[model samples]
Target: MDRTFTEHLLQWYDANRRDLPWRSNPEPYGVWISEIMAQQTQMERVVAYWRRWMERYPDLGSLAAASEEEVLKVWEGLGYYSRAKNIRKAAELILTDHAGVFPDEIKQIQALPGIGAYTAGAIASIAFNKVAPAVDANVLRVFARLLDIAEPVKAAKVKQEVEQAVLPLIPEKRPGDFNQALMEFGAMICSKRPDCDQCPMSQHCAAFANGTTGERPVLPRKRKAIHIEMATGVLVYNDKVLIQKRKPDDVWPGLWEFPGGCVEKGETPREALVREYMEEVELEIYPAEKITVVSYSYTKYRVTMHCYLCHSANNGQLKPVFNEAVTGQFVSPESLSSYAFPAGHRRLIECMLDEAWFDNLK
Candidate 1:
């Protein structure tokens, strides 16, 4: 790679970089939080979450002391709840293992939960001025185009080559600025549909010269989304809805949802709901009329949920048998506002509200 590319990119970045909140005062804690939130999330959407999160737990000590419920509550709408959990765990480790100080060394930072190579490199270079490369998808795209490499960008071998290519370009005195500049450049000028006409690195980009900017960064083939059909029972007894708390290790840990599971083959939605309630809470339910259906997309699968209004088969005599991993409770319709629920369950709650079912309860 030409040395002029780094100089020109830095100049462009100094003039054109977005005035992000994390950029205002780049501290290790704040940058770490921002990086974690920014993963698989857009920058525009993350700004407000980052601001509110910083306000709630301003330092490592506060985050370390917070309960999982409190942490998940603050991170309610932020998908990938595990990131929030990992951040809290990392905070606690920093406090106890590292004596409440954000470690400046890349290895030490990487030792924390959820701190992978990309995140560790970002924190090290951006916050600590270490000569490290932060090779995220943006950087990968940039590097692939700059050198006009055709290897799959997501491949491990390609990533290793990109990291090596970027290492030599890191300026000794301003490694952080250079690293951030590369990321910012890729984000703004060298995107998937790059603006080559306005790009400062257009003259230096081999893909642009070769007229292959759009095709150089080869991505892995996408897997088809698996379609899943599910049924959930919204059991309302004596004006209280029965909800189950997910196991800590489950997908949406600690979140409340109507008791049910995926619909099995060769079974009706109603039958699935009855069986699910029995399996999940050990309570027999008489599945009633279909209340609503909701569709949601997860990372690997698309789910269509069939929700039904249900009643206890024993005429309210059956109480939920709480196991060690999962628990259940009956909550008033109005009180449901206080609990956090998955997106699909939240939609179910909205449907019940829209139909005024809770208002008609005797």
Candidate 2:
């Protein structure tokens, strides 16, 4: 345990931590939510979502009582759907086993659905006032530069080494502040393109001293961007709407969405939709209004959705659009309440329902 490092970092934190709401109380639930929101998302964006979420679901008891669809709706556009799922599961576990109180012990906290070692350490240190090591990406970056370690810090196995190195350095009286200081230091000073001139640790930072500020702790390369061109049909007959269910084997399994297909390299969105319709549903559609365009990102790929309001030229027959979707039906606006639509579909639906005054307002 390097007492000097811990003290030095915490001293800097006293003047420089960000003004975030979650930092006010060190509540376990608040910290947990912040940590989850911070994953694969920008801190600025997470701040808004976090504030709204805490207001919506104040505690585990309230979260466990909410429906799955409602929870997912609240978590829409955040991506990484599993984080919301695990959070709900953890809420249920807390209600059933822990009697609604969040567990304070490191092992118990780690045993929760979404809580890992870093999360466990965070909750314990920040909420319970324990001296647990909180090691995350920021901490790893900071420590890697400080120790001049050049290995790829993201190698899953290196987590233990990072945790061990910080374990002994945690301050005894204010471990939570110490952990936050290290994270803040990494975020503000020892960043990817760090400003060593303004850093408190620049004098002691091994990487800065050796002029290897940008070289140590090499991160793994990012995956190639997945390209997709999808065609979505906004079918309207009378005042009703048309939507289909995505089968369990489908990419967006169990979600309700407009009928569409991915476009090939040479084909346009409209052409792809027509081709997919013939192949999947054995139905022909005459395009009417090209309504709007939307986009969303999944784990491995991104989607560009071209929505077209279409009508059957001859009121033609409709059938399953591919083996992945077995049902294609028209629905009253009221029926929307019974279905769980994908986030993008729901947004599109809202726009469709608001079409009358949308132009006037625009």
Candidate 3:
């Protein structure tokens, strides 16, 4: 472990640290929220969401007691709905078993839902002032570059090696600040395309000396995108549009929105819509011209939605084709203001409705 490197990085962080909302007082609840929001998410976007989340559920108690639907709504556009669910579960556990007090011990914190080694270490150190090593992407990158390690960071063995290497360097006096300073340095100076000249550790960094700063922490290969096609019907009758409630176990579970399905290989968008509508909603649809398309992005995949206007030929007899949709209903376009749609669907509906498509139907 390089003692000088640690001191230099910490000094640089103290002088150049960004004034982020979560770092205000290092509250356990606030730190926990920020860490969760940052998992597989960027810092810039997490800032706004973190501020809004704190405003709504400032403490663990408020979040623990809130309904899942409400929590999902708050985390609507964020994607990875399971993170929000696990957060609630952790809060509930803290409220029930721990009496709403966050556990200070690393093992006890790690036992909570959604919390792993890094998260537990972070909470235990930064918030509870305990001696723990929090190794995340930034820490991994910093250490990998410092040691000139070429192993892919995703490999369990490589990650373990990196943790072992950096664990000895954590200052006994303030492990929390040490961890944050390293992470901040990796974020600002020793970035993916590192600026060696600006990095405080460049003087002794192994990767810098070897001229392989960008190549030390090799990342794993990315998976190919999964293509899914859904034929959908923007089923309309009179002034009302059709919607169905998703099953509690399904993705975007319990949310309400339009009818559609994956477009099969060689199937047209309208045909897929007809098949999906019949299979999922148990109704026949005559899809009109394309109305709108909504593109939603996530860490591993992206969905491009193509919606079309249609009239229900079956009139009143409608049953959900798949068990995931428990029930179906029709709401007037003007009256849809009261119903809650999935965030993506809401955006698509707004786009279609704003163009006066519903008005022309009358």
Candidate 4:
């Protein structure tokens, strides 16, 4: 363990750390929540979401008692809905298994539903002040450059090497602060474009000294963007729309959505919506006016979702008799917020609300 490197990192952190709420008053639950929220989300965005979440479900008891839909609704717009689901699941497990206390040991933390090695380390070290190494994407990048590692940092074997390297460097005293400093340093200074001038430990960075910082943290090439055409129908009967819960095996699984499916080859968006409704929910509907077209990207998939206002073709007989395989409901416009919807669907709702489209339901 290089004492100087640890010294420089913690010194910089003490001077320039972000004054986040979780840091001001550190605790297991709040720190764990913040770490989870920070995954794949901007720090600023996580801050607002985390604050709102803490206010509503402050303790494990509140979170464990909350309904799945309520948890999903609170976590809406964060994407990775599974993480939110896992958080609630883990909370319940803690209540039952750990007596409602977030585990302080690294192994116990890692055993929780969504807590991987990186997250486990973060929560254990930062929250409980356990002497554990926190190796996130930022830490990986920082170390890859520091050690001049040429292999892809994301490779499983390489990640293990990096994680092990940081282990011995975690000072026993204020270990949590040390881990946070490394994460913060990597995020603010040793980022993709290294701010060497601002970096406290620049002298120890092998890539910087060797002038190979740009190429040190080798990353895999990004996946090609796949374009998908989808159609969804808002089956209106009065002020209510028929919505269905997605199958657990489907993409964006278990979320509520307007009944729809992908536009197969050569099929029009209108035809796809009508066909999907019949197949999924046994509803024969005529696709009416186009409500809105939504364009969004998730992971490597780019979706062009054509949303439409639809009406029953069964001569105004709107009784939806769902079969054994389907789950659906016709809910009023004001009640849509009670369930969580995908970001694109939520945006479509925004458009629906703006024009009061429910007024046109026949």
Candidate 5:
């Protein structure tokens, strides 16, 4: 079954393959970048981001030379900001430790920040043409059905079982293409709704023979989202609004946003904004008008941020003392787009623009 499965899958892959920009050349650096950006992101969206990122950074040297702020800006709207930071760190490590060359060995690549076992396997197989199994969501789904694993795919033990079963199927000469074919086959044919009739491996698939395709790859129950209410102030002085960079360890690290904190029990959003601003930045400003309310999700938290306009400065204390942020800046209304902001804060900016709120500040 294993040999026949391998032969059939490879033949099918040659006939039906995705024509991606990164696939044409498959350079080590380009493949690494594409793999990192593809995590938890849709392929269509990842294609555009990968193109923009490759154009901007070009190679490992340029990416290593870039500042965290610059990298974060380029990765804006990509959702996972830590991926940007991690790749930059990895790039710097490659330059310093390996003389700017991407590591060929899986162990060496895994030593880099944010490159886990799955990612390491992907890079080693796809970039270096090594015999490694890269098991992503797509591969896991395909494997669970092909091998007829009854346990939930999310379970660690089940994942290990799938990987072990797939290890021997990776061809020696074209291991990279083999891994990509498995990923593509999972994404296209053996998907959530597997087209059993069209699948080349249908005859070899244990789940199809047993009539348990849908139930083969058991999925875990979805977790409920936690709700959070937060408040922030847009304090303007001299036609500029004060913004703060979130602390490095905060939820939205390395991103700029209005200064605020979560609303405590018995406190209104307006009162929370004033108190949070005072406690966080030592800036005393009365919340004058409610500018915008934004709702966004991160991880499992569903956040609702109340943004207020603090048009006047109390006690003439314009200088900020940092607590919740690493640094604070008062930027012009027109320059807000220059900095990378959290999704909620970015939405606030869009809402203000739609309402022409910047004109009132001027």
Candidate 6:
């Protein structure tokens, strides 16, 4: 690696850095929150959420004192609900273990619930100005193209090699700026379809010199998405819908959704909904008209959900099976705003509103 590339990259960053909200006030707690929210999410989308979050919980003490429900409510549509839970857990740990102060050390930051090596490095370098490397997808892409690395970027060995390569370039005086410059360069110039012509480091980029800029950062082949079909019951009584809280071990934990489960191999959607409601809530529900079919994709599976309007048999009260961790309740449609729901269920709410199911209640 040549030093001139670093010099040009830094100069370009100084002249063209985006005016992000986190950059305006780079406190440790705010930086930590922004980094977590920015993962797998675009920066433009994260800005509003980050600002609202900062206003709601100004510091570690406020976040530490917040309940999981409150935290998830703010993080409702962010997807990846586990990150919200982990942030709360990390905040509590910081309060109890570190006296409500964000840890400055890289290892201590990584010790938090969801703070991985990348997040820790980001906070350490950006907020604390420590000589650390934050090698996320963007950084990996930038380095792979710059060095013409042909290995799969997702592989552990490739990642380790990139980290080793990055460590030597961290200037002691401006480590944070250098790290952010590399990240910004990747994001703006050297993306999946890079703007190689506009890149300040084009002369130094090995892949560009070899005319293989697009082919350098090779990734492993992705597995096919597993298809899943589900049936869900939208139980309404006196204008209130029965929603179940997902189990902590379940996907999208801490978020509420319509009561239902996967459709069995031979069962119809309505039959599956009836059976699921009986087993999970111990309530017999009569499935009525089909409300809507919703589809969503997770990282590994694609799901199609069949939701139906259901009423309790004989208007019987639900005897929900509740453990210490998971529970169910009936809440008015208006009250849904207070709880965080999965995107599919959120869309279901819109459908209900469109059908005027809650208009009379309002």
- Provide C-alpha RMSD values for all models, in order: 2.0, 3.6, 2.4, 1.7, 1.8, 1.9
lDDT of 4 at 238: 68
lDDT of each: 0.88, 0.79, 0.80, 0.88, 0.88, 0.88
For model 3, how does the per-residue alpha-carbon lDDT over 1-362 read when each residue is reduced to its tens digit?
57776787678878998888878799899999999898877889899999999999999989988898788777866767788889999999999999889889898999999999999999888898887788899888888888888888878987899788878888888788888887788788877888788666677788888988768788888888765544456777766678887887877776777888677788888888887877776678788678877777545666777888888767565544654486778778876665556666888778876898778663
lDDT of 2 by residue, 1-362 (tens): 35776677777889889998899987999999998888878889899999889999998888999886677767776766668878999999998999889998999999999889888998899888899999989989987888787788888667778888888888778888888888778778787888788888777788888888788777889898897778888666665667777775666555667777888888888888887767665667766777788787777678888888776654544444454485768787767766767767777777766775123210
Clashes of each: 0, 4, 9, 0, 0, 0
Show model 2 residue runs off by greater than 4 Å: 245-255, 278-283, 313-362
Show where candidate 1 strays beyond 4 Å.
Answer: 322-325, 351-357
List the pairs of residues colliding in candidate 4: none
In candidate 4, clashing pairs total 0
lDDT, candidate 4, residue 70? 92
State how far residue 348 of model 6 sits from its true place (Å): 0.8
Which lDDT tens digits does candidate 6 get at residues 1-362?
86777788799999999998888778899899999999989988899999999999988888889999999999988898889989999999999999888999999999999999999999999999999999999999998998899888899999999999999888888888898998898888888888888777888889999998878799888898899999887887877888888888888888898888899998999999998888887788888888899998878999999989898885545566644228788898888888889998988888978887667541
Prediction 1 global C-alpha lDDT:
0.88
Cα lDDT, model 2, residue 57: 99
In candidate 4, stretches whose alpha carbon ends up further than 4 angstroms from where it belongs are 321-326
lDDT of 1 by residue, 59-93 (tens): 99999998987888788777888899899999999
The 10-residue segment with the lowest total lDDT in model 1: 316-325
Question: Rank by TM-score, descending?
Answer: 4, 6, 5, 1, 3, 2
| Candidate closer to the true structure by lDDT (higher is better), 4 or 5 | 5
Q: Return the lDDT, model 5, position 100.
A: 88
Candidate whose lDDT is highest = 5
Weakest lDDT window of 10 consecutive positions for candidate 6: 316-325
Looking at candidate 4, the ten consecutive residues that score lowest on lDDT are: 317-326
